[model samples]
Target: MVFRHENIRITIIAALYFAVAIAEVMCELYAYKPLIYVFKPLMPAMLMVLYFNTSRKRSALFFIVMTLSLITNVLFIPDSQDLLFYGLVVFLAHRILLLYYIIRLLKINDYIPAIIATIPFLLVYFYLFMITNGIPENSFVVLIFQNILISFICGIAFSHYVMQDSRRNSWLLQCGILFGALHFIVFVEKFYLTGFSPTIFRPMAMGLNAFAFYTFYEFVMATEKSHRDDARSIA
Candidate 1:
């Protein structure tokens, strides 16, 4: 019964994911969002669907949503520059590595694997960003530092949330809340500072945040299960 319920939830979330992608593209058309050329937020959205979508039906919905988002981007922004394609391929490769590591590392606490994992994660983003964006000599080091710091902050937050909690569902929800709040703040900052950054940015940001909030809320509920498990172990 609970499994069925989670399927229903995944379906709803998958629909919401599609909506956010459309909204984000609209924002790009109007407000000229500079930082998100590579669709970074989509990574988190995929992560969300992966979390709740265990059943085939829900998984299909997730696959469709992600595919549609890609198609939407292609339809609207069909520039297809060499560098863009290059960076994109690199990013996809990096994502593959991330997904692999995320799954294999689950249930393991050893720090060695993590240290080994960081090499691909760091080099992939660093070299690709430099190549795609053409890092200026003067600001090269600074750019790398800033990017590294931001990624470190985000990754550490996820690690802390996931590792500190043995309950995977709770960890997932905490991550959702963290992501939701993070994007919300980013959207607001851009909206307030720039005013009318393509009508879509705000909604996309809010939608993503809402998505995060749901997962986080679910995680809260899951704590009860963890408590019960602990009680059983103690007994």
Candidate 2:
């Protein structure tokens, strides 16, 4: 009975998530600027609801990350440069907290593997730096720092997966971080680089972000379950 109830709950949440996501994409494609304000924030808000309903062991850190994400989403809805900067600042905090949360789950036994894993992420960061253009002087420093944080998150996630190939949680974390990095890269390209179509990139970024949040939630749940199992074994 409990399993059936959980399944039903997940199905409802998933339907709501897809509906909101599609609505947001339609708003973006049709240039319904005002409607975007309604659907855009709903994306993360739906995820937060899903987390609260589905998670057996909810981490406060993850809850805070989602709250910050919702705030950033609202901040980015406005066209003002000041709001954008503020959104970036809030998002930086989100990433920092997310990184710390992931680090707590990781057990680093070999520094060499971790160090080697960061090399590819560093290369990607440099490539993005070389390619992206027209970044405002004021926003440039924050953007750079944010990208570095993203790289570290991706690197740590990748290294964790490499070390724990058998764990599903590791895979979820890796995919989530990579999807998030890709979403941000697309965002930078759309806003800063020339000739990118907002029609194509906007929906794409939103979809990637949705996947990232879902996977992160799964990672948290899986890790929490593992922790419980470990405790039981010790007992």
Number of colliding residue pairs in each model = 2, 0
Q: Please give each candidate's TM-score.
A: 0.32, 0.87
**Candidate 1's C-alpha lDDT?**
0.45
- What RMSD does model 2 have? 2.4
lDDT of 1 by residue, 149-231 (tens): 43442353355455565565445636534553543344233323344345555545545544553454344335445555667
Q: Which residue pairs show collisions in model 1?
A: 31-197, 31-198
- Runs of candidate 1 exceeding 4 Å displacement: 1-157, 161-181, 184-193
How displaced is residue 221 in candidate 2, in Å?
Answer: 0.9
| Model 1 residue 155 distance off true place after TM-score fit, in angstroms | 5.8
Question: Which candidate gets the maximum lDDT versus the true structure?
Answer: 2
